[model samples]
Target: MIKDSPNPPEHLFAVRPNLDTETLLVNASQDLASISDIAVHLAFEVDGAQRNVALGICRMLEGVQLLVNKALDEAYPAT
Candidate 1:
């Protein structure tokens, strides 16, 4: 079950590793791809609103993937 918190802590934050840009991008791309795959699988396995939510997550991840790829291309242009 999901929990909802009203007025959630404003200072909530995660401590990120001190990784370089290329490493961070590679890690994020792999993680997001894994999440997208899981979301796609769960979406097909479920019905109604739950499936819709899962598909929505997949779509958001796809968008992020595109943006990340663009950043990668800009960072390391093709020869």
Candidate 2:
């Protein structure tokens, strides 16, 4: 049987609206670090241009992680 219309998309994951800035920054920093690790590992598995691209992605993710960390530090200073 053919459907007349497409079914609505289901969102399996979403951020909690009540989360504070520090929590969000921490999560972002962790995610960026994880992605950077994956990229670095992938870079080793490939060669030439593909390897360069993966390493480049790793570098960019590192920069983003630094930014997130800075924001977190600024938002919640240590005693």
In model 2, the runs with Cα more than 4 Å from the true position are 1-12
lDDT of each: 0.88, 0.91
- Across 4-42, the per-residue lDDT of candidate 1 in tens digits comes to 887787668854778778777777788889999999999
- Determine which window of 10 residues in candidate 1 has minimal summed lDDT: 10-19
lDDT of 2 by residue, 4-77 (tens): 55765477588889998988998899999899999999999999999999999988998989999999998899
- Backbone clash pairs for candidate 2 read none
Each model's TM-score? 0.74, 0.83
Name the regions of candidate 1 deviating beyond 4 angstroms. Answer: 1-18
The all-Cα superposition gives candidate 2 an RMSD in Å to the true structure of 3.2
Candidate 2 — worst ten consecutive residues by lDDT sum? Answer: 3-12
Indicate which candidate wins on TM-score: 2
lDDT of 1: 0.88
